[model samples]
Target: MGNKNISMAVIRRLPKYYRYLADLLAKDIQRISSKELSEIIGFTASQIRQDLNNFGGFGQQGYGYNVEALHREIAKILGLDKKYKAILVGSGNLGQALTNYSGFKNAGFDIMAVFDANPRMIGLKIRDYEIMDSDLIESFVSENNVEIAILCIPKEGAQQVADRLVKSGIKGIWNFAPVDLDVPSSVIVESVNLTESLFTLSYLMKDGEEA
Candidate 1:
């Protein structure tokens, strides 16, 4: 199957495999069998083999997977090599925290600029980039060729801002707003609803305690 045809479950697992392989590489380990990797990441050997095989099977039959090689392959599949440009909107607590995260840049989603609707926040600097007025988002996105937008705006205004982002040619949005956004079918929006996630975690913890 082509990469585009890969299942979402397999796609989601790619980052896990990439992270574990990176750890092994950092520890100076050169190779790992599927069975060994499964033990480390809590996946079945067959599952690991099957998932990697979907992308042409990086592992050899006898020698197993080369850690660095497999990591590079997974990172390629995840588009970490592209260093996609992104912009952050709504420079509140969540937005600032996301801007402060170095992992996003390390993983190739570089936030080129930050913006806020608040006049007080517009001139503030986060890290190296100055926060600009949200009014300038369209022109900034156009000039920068930004592929993704990170939205940390309030729910009430999320849809309007998302519409503007879509109009400005952003292909993807990483939304942290409480409400869902309505965008074109061609535009992908990944919403991170922190409250819902916390509730789910609470449920899991309660179940574990009862068990």
Candidate 2:
């Protein structure tokens, strides 16, 4: 199927499917039918089938999907096998937490360098790499093959830093800043709005109480 044809809703569910499939594989679960998988993930059987079908059908009519095989296919779809060389652009609490997250590597995002504007944080080591000066971002990116940038900087400085990253040849930006960013069409930006998600949870809880 063409990229334009696929709904964002389906795209958003990809990671959930990938994680659940990985869990199944870990448990040595050999195979799973759509209905059984739906029971586990809370999606309907037809919904799961439709989502998987969008990327080319992996399951058969009589038989089910092979857990390992399905997991591998989803991993391929998510580009988990290709470990992307990435840089982190903040050194504060959120930045430090993200730097310590080993799951990013397992999911194919390799954060090689951490950058901060703070002079005090420049020399500090987080995980394996020392935090570098944010001023050096343009030059460092120019010198290295940096594919993705993790934006953990404050909202006030995010746009400027993102501009530098885009100019320095970073194609993807995983933005954790509170404010929304305006980037060019070529540069992909995925914003993780923590506050928005929290508010959404609150709304859901209130709605449940009313129901």
Candidate 3:
């Protein structure tokens, strides 16, 4: 099946599967049955099977799945095998924390540079990268062939920055700003709203209390 035909729910679960498979590999586990994966991953065995089937079932009916091979396949499916040149558009607390995270680099997303509108933050070092002025973003992205952008700025300027990113050939955006961005259909955007997520958790807790 083509990726477009896959449900977003299945696509989101791919990362969880990849992570658990990697954990199993580290434990020196070799092969795993769908039921076995279900126990650890908290999904029903049938659900696991169906999810995997979306991208061509890799598990054998009797022999189950080879842990190493499954992990590699999931990595490729998630595009983790390819390297992405990315840039960060904010250098505030959240932005700095993201820069400090080594996981992004390990997963093939290299943050080539950081940009910020604040005058004080300009020229400041976040690890090896010195923060550049936001005005230079378009040129920098075009010149460096950046494919992804991580936006950690406030909602006020998020859309403006997104526009600049799209103009400069950014294919994907990992957005942390609370506001939704308006961009071309060809440009992919994944947004994380901390307040909204926390609010969801709060609502669930309230419902549990009322129940």
Candidate 4:
């Protein structure tokens, strides 16, 4: 099956595979059987096989999988091989934290600029980037050919900022605004709702206690 046909559940599991494989590689592990991978990743051997098969089975029947090869493949699949020019709006606590994160840059998402509406926050620096006026976002995005936007603004203004980003040719958004964004099908939005995730953890803990 083609990538579009792959289920989200399987796609979600791919990152885990990539991380564990990276860990194995770091430990000087060369190859691992499906059963061994399952034990480490907490997925059943059959499930791991099925998941990898969706992206073309990378493992040999008896030889299992080459850790380095699998890690490289997964990185390519996740688009980590290419660099993306990104702009961050909302340079408050969350936005500043995201800007300070070096991991995104290492993974090919380079945050080129940071923007803020607050006059107090404007002209501030996060890492090497000096916070710019939100008014300049559209121009900056259009001029620089920005591919992605990281939204850490409030929910009330998130949609407005998103509209501006979409109009300026942004293809993807990493939204931390807590509200679901309304964007075109051509534009992909990956949202992170911290409260919702925390609530999920709380639910699981409560369920375990009741059980």
Q: Put down candidate 4 lDDT per residue, 32-144, tens digits, no spaces.
A: 99999999999999999998988888999999999999999999888888999999999988998989999988888999999999999888888899899999999999999
Residue 125, candidate 1: alpha-carbon lDDT: 93
Model 3, residue 175: what's the lDDT?
99
TM-scores of the candidates in the order shown: 0.95, 0.95, 0.99, 0.97
Per-residue error for 77 in candidate 2, Å, reads 0.9
- Prediction RMSDs, each to the true structure: 1.4, 1.4, 0.8, 1.2
- Residue 133 of model 2 has an lDDT of 90
**Consecutive 10-residue window with the lowest summed lDDT within model 2:** 1-10
Instruction: Give the C-alpha miss distance for residue 159 in model 2, angstroms.
Output: 0.5
Compared with the true structure, what per-residue lDDT tens digits does model 1 show for residues 8-35?
Answer: 9999899999899989999999999999
Better of 3 and 4 by TM-score: 3
Off by over 4 Å in 4: none
Sort all candidates by lDDT, best to worst: 3, 4, 1, 2
Candidate 3 has which clashing residue pairs, if any? none
The prediction achieving the highest TM-score against the true structure is: 3
Per-residue accuracy of model 3 over 97-151 as CA lDDT, tens digit each: 9999999999999999999999999999999999999999999999999999999
Model 4, position 16: C-alpha lDDT score:
88
Off by over 4 Å in 2: 209-211
lDDT agreement of model 1 with the native: 0.93
Candidate 2, pairs of clashing residues: none
